[model samples]
Target chain A: MIGGRLGIIVSGSLTKGVEVRLDSAISVEDIAVGRYVTIEGEKRRFFGMITDVTLDAIDQRVMATPPDVSDPFIAEVLAGTTTFGRLHVLPVLTIGGDALSLLEGPQPVKTVPVHFSVVREASEQDVEQVFGQVEEKQFYIGTPLDMETKVRLNPAELVKRSNGIFGKSGTGKTFLARLILIGILQEGAAVNLVFDMHNEYGWKGSSEDRREVKGLKQLFPSKVAVFALDEESARRRKVSTDFVVEIGYDEIEPEDIAMLRETLGLTDAAVQATYRLARRFGERKWLESFLAIEGREELNELASSLGEHEATMAALRRRLDSLRRLRFLVPHARDNAIQRILDYLDRGINVVLEFGRYTDYTAYILVANLLTRRIHAQYRERMERALGEDIAKPRPLVITIEEAHKFLNPDISGQTIFGTIAREMRKYNVTLLVIDQRPSGIDEEVMSQLGTKITCLLDNERDIESVLTGVSGKSELKAVLAKLDTKQQALIFGHAVPTPVVVKTREYGSPQSYKELGFREALELKKKAEEEAKDLWG
Target chain B: MPAKIGEVIEASSGEFTAQCYELHQPPSFGSLVKTREGEVEIYGVVSGAATTSIEPGRRPIARGREEAEEEDIYRSSPQLSKLLRTDFNALIVGHKEGQKLHHYLPPRPAKIHSFVYLCDAEEVEKFSQSFDFLSILVGAGGQADELIAASLRHAAAAHQDPRDFLIKAGKELAVLLGGETNRLNNILRRIKV
Candidate 1:
């Protein structure tokens, strides 16, 4: 049977949600917060989630001097009449119960259900109707709590704006990110440019139990390109690399250093001095020229000539000297790494740039910021040209970055390219898929700008608050988000899903899962084709 | 036909007093009994019963001092049966109008001298189908809890499943006495099978 009738709407309001009085026959133990339910009103059916449960009695004296309920007879009699359970439901969408709703589908509820409306646990059909069925652009992410019905997320709507995936460490953020990436790929929504800091996405990544799972390249070889910053590390891991990305010292600019001020512990004067050096040596030669200065006397001569404070100049030199230790940075590059990435993205091939062993904060911030700044500028130019000439716009791009707080923290969000993309990059056909553990550390404005947010269990009060910032029914959703399972569970809301839902993230990393995701080797496909041909001939 | 238990000796809209056919043989406390007035049948539960001297203020002397058994005194003085009479009081819980049974006070009292009969198992089963009368019984003033416990026990005897019936009746009492937990608990203790 579909969900049996649980209760009736006893008393409620539109702003504070509705209260349901449970029937005497239903036990309160069977009810859980965050479970979905439907209310059959006079005119339409409303869908909502259970947010709270309470035990109540008709008279306060019954609680003061309690009845002798030790005997089963007294207990049974008093179970519902003298004492009962009450539920608090937040109605979100009105399911099809009227002619208008029947044609247009579910709509956001603007009114409360009439008094005494019946409420039942949401059935599979009701859930499927509200979340929609899997079709061309809809990808199945996971099932709602305790249900077998799949919840579909439309990747097409998802890539139109920036989004975030957050959780505490080891809360399966990586696994969910992988699933979303696969969703984007399957839907062909946009081309992904992932800054793979730990080399997790390009090749095989380990699960929590240290089991290796196939990466994106293994799943779609022809559609994905893996670029490694450390050639030796990529070879060590036995991963086939498509490109080696190295940043030339001449490629570094003053603004890139300014964004890294906090990570490098550089003083304000030191940051300002980089601009002076850039102006003196020209935009492309500042870092190479500054690093070539040999001794304190020569540095002092330049600082005096430029009228820069001696201490600030020395500190800037010392900080700039640390950049030499990063093996991927050289005086000159053999090829343009940004242009190569652009070429791959233009051809609709997703690129995962592996940092390999340089997972240090300084390196990740510098390289990611430097590359994104130039790339965003190029995209801006191209988008304008497309608009002016009435030509086809560039393919939509989604940049995936981890440890996003480092780049999007309040101080640097005003200057970093990631912030620009997050704020208003949709006009230029670019967006960000930010993955972070401390969402509280990200700028509030940027967090609000995210199109959709999928978050795992976050026990910290601040992180939970940050994730639910601009969402309607914030307090109610906070309870659901806080109660999510530590692994393989998340609460997704916003643009893609019709309403907020707590999902047991779809399974990944097994042979059966791989098969379901359409993973096949070239030889196997060819063999199958040959057998089909043989069957046709015979 | 059911045995005639009594006749109404005194009547009121809410309650009626009936004289049993035999001395010292009034109906049991809380058992249901009924009487007819022309076309209407008025139902009531036996609230209290007593046997006393036929005339008020007439105290009889002891006559069984030398008798070996209590029956010998009554046998020796045959007129004793005429001197003593038993009567019972029933609160008008409901009445039968046409074919329907209501759980409310009838429009008029059972007529004086109306013949009363103790309801059988089938009638008791049919009458107890709805618990709407429990509210009237609960509000019947002084020792109402005891009267309710006894009535439900007697009513449960007519059902195939007595414990299930008692539980259902107990739940009804729980709702009616929702504000009085102690009274409900006391009655539930008596009615539990």
Candidate 2:
């Protein structure tokens, strides 16, 4: 290899083993072992390691020998002294070159700090180049997938399931979740049921200009349906409304009833009585059952006796009151929302249940629990009917739970509806996309069960570690994540990506700026604007 | 003989002699009394008769000329508190004064409020030897002056600190004010304490 220029020869045992003094222009502090150093006229760079530093007498006799003869001569000359270890000025060079080059100065090298093989640059013919790189997919619930970086997902893998999204306030978790749902829907592979707690998604425009619509007439006019639950029609009329529905107590199986009873914090005796009451009213239907019990003092007396002997009367009364509030069992409801969901699933259309506006954590949990159990039961029944056994068959439904950590928590008294769905969903083609800012808080088993993961800018180290543990072959991806810009930039791993990619998320319609205004500030701004407009008008 | 109110006493026990500032009349038999400073509580027996050759206790009263001089100083001295309210303003004001102020001002005291008690004659004598009681009053008066100098230094450092506002201010001040203000750039190069 050609060398740049010759400086002072500090020490040399042989031509190749010379210590040449250099100037202070170069900051060699950052140089490392595996770096490639290029000479001024050389076509290729020589790779070298930083060996050692020496300061002492300048010995000119050592520089006389040639490159080929230098190794043995230097070893012999520097033997049995401290200079033997310290004499060699720099570390050993793996690449061999001419001896004459050693009389010249060392050139700088380009550092490769991270492990990544350079792939062929983007060509005109590549689909990615033509369409432009797929922007990062902003999911409502799953980890963020950066479109800029390339990741490969295997579609033929054994893990086929839905996902859940979860995070605390202002973590942009809901936005990420919606993006995941939109991606699945775009793929046209599986139907989805999104429990949108705040009614934030399923709108045509960005989050800022989102308009509320009852049905999917604007966006997915062909395949999607949006249903809003109405309270009045659900209670007065037994008839299902257009978009509202009631879950009949009779339809809930004994086991599911037990689970619900546990979730509602009902006592054992109350649970048993509710089950019996449900079975007795099964033949007459919900409205007729109420009518049948209206004037009957005998049934009341029986209830009282049972209440005194085995159950808390107050607890039973409260459970009955709760049952009355259920939208499905209420008569004259505008539409059975659950039935519509079932119908959509049957028709293989994705449904977005936007609950984005709801802040009540308990209400969100209850809705999620109800929907998941219903879906599970429906899937099991269908699978049993088709397979002649209770073996789970792949149903083309994926449920995406946004803010999933709240519902899937093992610490909660209720059954782990989300966790159960995550574990068992794959069997019935019911997949879960669990998205959370703090992935560490999510149940470890449920997180492990998620076949695919998309990760974004994770500020928390524990979340990053948990994500890394869940996905494989992501060492390079982890390094890339350290330098990611805060946009919707993210690294996607697991079955969703064949390889990890750092991607900037695509703008969905008009970008919805969910910029929160502090309560007082928003009010003040509104009042100020109104006053200003009025003044101008006057 | 019991000590009278306002009399000073030297309670001697070998080398331990405390000059007590008597606030109340000593009782018969002259019991020793102890009271906490800055508190209303009184403890112990009353001390015996005491006297001092030093000037009798006199309430502190600001002289008319001194008060007028203080008012003048307050008006002339730049409000460092207000100046430091905004980092940008602090930089501007600090750049204006710079090293000249630092040269005239005493070194910044380690503690802003330091108190030394003059409880007894021997303690008073020891304190008198170490520090001038008159100079202490003068020293206390110069606190605001010292603060002004420190504020200037802080502002000068801030302007040279490479922040966007400081850089802009430095550039503007150079164009408008001119002269050796350009030397403020050297402030940035200096090693921080």
Candidate 3:
């Protein structure tokens, strides 16, 4: 009903996609890229996702030169000439039977939006069926551009497997993550643990524009616990840190040091010396014992005694000495950070570990691996314990990891614990919301395991190629992906939506958007509408 | 409704080809013309129109071009124009039988030498209500785009509500040439009436 009769389909082949010229009366504001539309065909209504929109002059007559360039007559003719807009719409599906029947599931449509059909802005009814009914386990992620309608996502599908959000820098990757996290929080579908490397998501964060974004802690204060690695750093930023996350030196193993070899720029001989140190003094006290030998002669004497490479041991000892100011790497802890995290998940409280000022790649990767590796073991055990037991099923957990490609790259994927979690998917009640720019760098095993990929505008072909590795209908989807705007727009497909859709992600941090994000209003209306629909269709 | 413009010189089931009785002047392109054969009234729009010399085997030859004014040359060779003639081709769009005006092509062709008359405003007004003739105007082929523009202009002038008539015709053009907006715009811009 909104923007009634936006345009009429003129001509376009099924393979090339449909070209709909806008009505002469319709303004440019009525349509845009990532807008959802509907074409009323003879037999059925075909729904489309607008991948591209372009303005066109009615003819090449605009190229004609006027006799006098200064004359108003010439300008009048040029101005009065008709120019129209063409919306290149990719038909996603068709609906023929009653609305209730479509709720069963989406039936993939291969047919095009027919010739000369009336194309209009898709109504709320079309959107509801297209994204699937919003009665339960549904959350509105964003609104499609140029619409009053909200585009919802099924959270149950998202948390049941791994998913990713990718974009180049400043393309709102973190902002999108925050919006979806709000959806997850509102739906209460799963517990979300975000490893906040930039300390931006728990409290108020600002975009590059310096506009303030309302964070998870502000939205769900009681349910979210913000644990900062450095409490002093959090205090300076005016954020309340619930617990100080510190790892015991005892938790550091030879493999933990080995994992940091590439990051620390250590050689093969240096890595061998790290393992030799772990063998000489057990895994629990190896770093402490190795650091205790300050002199090169003392390190050489220890290396000689152990029959190891003296110079290599000296290089490894020198690298370990640089871990002086790390707040998380302490000599002892009252309790393990992994146990605290498990307790939070068991109680259904989401934990966001904020690395306040420890934003270095080396510091972030080292602590994240240590925490996630131990936490994975505990969650796996918990999932196994409740497999056949009378105990209640644990809540599903989503681990939000930023810079995911660092740990998930093919070179170290076999050694990293995330590779196992990515391969296992939802088995341990834990899945990843992998946030990164370089999806091309993430392991293929993990990339294929990703259920839903919400991608922002990415210009790199390799990155786009990696993001679309095993996807069906990639050529069409590629054009859609390539056309996404640099901001707010996203191509969301996989387990949740019925088909690949380029949507203008809803407003983030606006009062109106916040009201919709609350779910108290939208969800209630959805329930009432569903009940009414059932009354009629039943 | 108007005076007899011509007689049907050539006739077919789908077309009515005629020449102006005055020889030098043919009905303007897109002007509605009709012919009567018994109870059937065949209607068409001027889709193809031209003026040519009637001499079968020879082209008109100009003489003394430099010495004579344009008018004096014509005066010197009065017989040159006697062999010249004006004619037009029509796409048999619709017909009228009995008292009812039907918006479809007539089944039978108008007989040869049947008198063709220019349609009056009342007939143009009635046909302008619906745009069934637009598809045939575009499909008529030769100078079809120009025909569409000329036809809209002629129809608009003959109607009481000229703007309303043009708008309705524009909407029809939106459907037929929706993909061909370039041509649609060209035709629509010429609807000055």
Predictions' DockQ, in order: 0.78, 0.00, 0.10
Off by over 4 Å in 1: A135-138, A520-538, B60-64
* Residue-wise C-alpha lDDT for candidate 2, range B5-71, written one tens digit per residue: 2211221111012333331222222122222223211122221223332334633333346445655
Better of 1 and 3 by TM-score: 1
lDDT of 1 by residue, A152-225 (tens): 88888999999999999999998899889988987799999999999888878888889999898887777899
Share of real contacts kept by model 3? Answer: 0.00
lDDT of 3 by residue, B38-143 (tens): 8999999888777787866777776765745787776787786788888888878788889877778887899999999988888888877778878887887768
Instruction: Give the runs in model 2 whose Cα sits over 4 Å from its true position.
Output: A1-159, A164-167, A204-217, A231-242, A252-304, A307-311, A319-339, A354-368, A381-395, A411-418, A435-441, A455-487, A500-502, A511-538, B1-193
In model 2 chain A, the worst 10-residue window by lDDT is: A112-121
Ranking by TM-score: 1, 3, 2
For every candidate, the chain B TM-score is 0.98, 0.17, 0.90
Q: Which is superior by lDDT, 1 or 3?
A: 1
Candidate 1 similarity to native, TM-score: 0.95
lDDT of 2 by residue, A421-528 (tens): 777756666767666667777767777776666665666766666667744323333444555555555555455542344445544444242211012233456688
lDDT of 3 by residue, A443-480 (tens): 99899999999999888899999999987656656777
